[model samples]
Target: MTPGPAGTTVPAAPDAPALLRGSGLRVTDQRVAVLEVLRGAPHADADDVVRAVRERLGRVSVQAVYDVLAALGRARLVRRIEPAGSPARFELRVGDNHHHLVCRACGEVRDVDCAVGAAPCLVPGASGGPVDGFVVDEAEVIYWGTCAACAATPALLATAPDA
Candidate 1:
């Protein structure tokens, strides 16, 4: 595992074929391509994946990429994030309780350590939460703010009220 930027040891993401096999999914070019693309890109969307696949292997259909993404999501090989007022995004950083820090100005996203360390925030509300008839397995936490680049430029933030 490598030391992540957030002071967490990040496990090396599995290769595409191995990931698919372990997840009980058959290996395919589309799946491998999608995983490869996501390996370097943290938060990509359907159109981004499709464009990347087509760049690597020309003539791939968007529907095909979406299908492969669906399979990967079902297998938990990838995590999808849907920030407010943003298209759904996907990442290969799975099996962790990390949160995301999204930039309001640029839509940039970065992985952050779980709140209270070791995923203590997973409880439905807080400590000993998910009170009755509820099972909280995950929590989607987003800290929205302007990125350094955007924050550096006051005029940009002024124009982008969303920032």
Candidate 2:
């Protein structure tokens, strides 16, 4: 596991085409390129993905990239996470109850392990919150804070008060 920007460890990205095949997704150039981009740069938005894919594969369209993302998302090969006030980002981390820490200052995102217990976080205190819930199965938690890089800069601190 490679340590991400924030202490969250990022799982090594699996082989491009192989991963797609495992997900039962038709292995295509665009699909491979999109996965490669996300593997190298997790939490990338659609625009960032489009630029990277085009860099690797001559030309690609925004709509096409979105289509690939949609396919990957449906196959559970990729995950779409939308942080409020920010564009939805994509990552390869799936089939787990991992969380994320989004930098409020610069929108940097990092993967975080399940806060308490195992997947789903169904047990009380397992989610770092009140245990009372109606058949909890998945936990989507985002810890918003100033990333180290932004905190050091000081000038870019978000104007919005800390939550």
Candidate 3:
């Protein structure tokens, strides 16, 4: 089990091999390890993933982890979010039009449900029509601010320059 918010514990993720097969991808030890790592550490970067996977399965190449992440991303098994001034992070929370909350001070990230209304929440301007005839499928919103921990720490807040 993984530690969750507020000292809670999250159950282990579903079987990796089954998830891979269901997503029509070939199952491998590397893929399974990568999925397990993401399950335990959501919003992990490529480097973090590589480190964890290597610890689990000795001598995993960095390229191998990147390849696995790419395959998983293409299969829609994982979602990639790139917050400003931070490396791309991966999570298993796919299929939802959710947004993100990024802490500027410490670069911590958290999930936020879709902002008001349905999928493609924010419409184009006052007319509520597509801008320049561009059809919108999803709205990616990132709320940038200080998180609770950062807000509580004066030194951390002071060190982070305004973006």
Give the top-scoring candidate (TM-score): 1
User: TM-score for each prediction?
Assistant: 0.90, 0.84, 0.88
Please give, for residues 53-160, the per-residue lDDT of candidate 3 as tens digits: 999999989999999999999999999999888999999877667788888889988877787988888887778888898888888899999999999999999998
RMSD of each: 1.9, 3.5, 3.1
lDDT of 2 at 44: 96
Task: Return the candidate ranking by lDDT, descending.
Answer: 3, 2, 1
Taking the tens digit of each residue's C-alpha lDDT, what string does model 2 give over 11-120?
Answer: 77669999988988889999999999998888999999999999999888899999999999999889999998999999988878898888887888888889888877
Better of 1 and 3 by TM-score: 1
The CA lDDT of each predicted structure is 0.84, 0.85, 0.87
* Two-way lDDT contest, 1 vs 2, winner: 2
Candidate 1 lDDT, 21-106, residue by residue in tens = 99899999899999999986768988999999999889998889989999999999989999898899999878787888888877
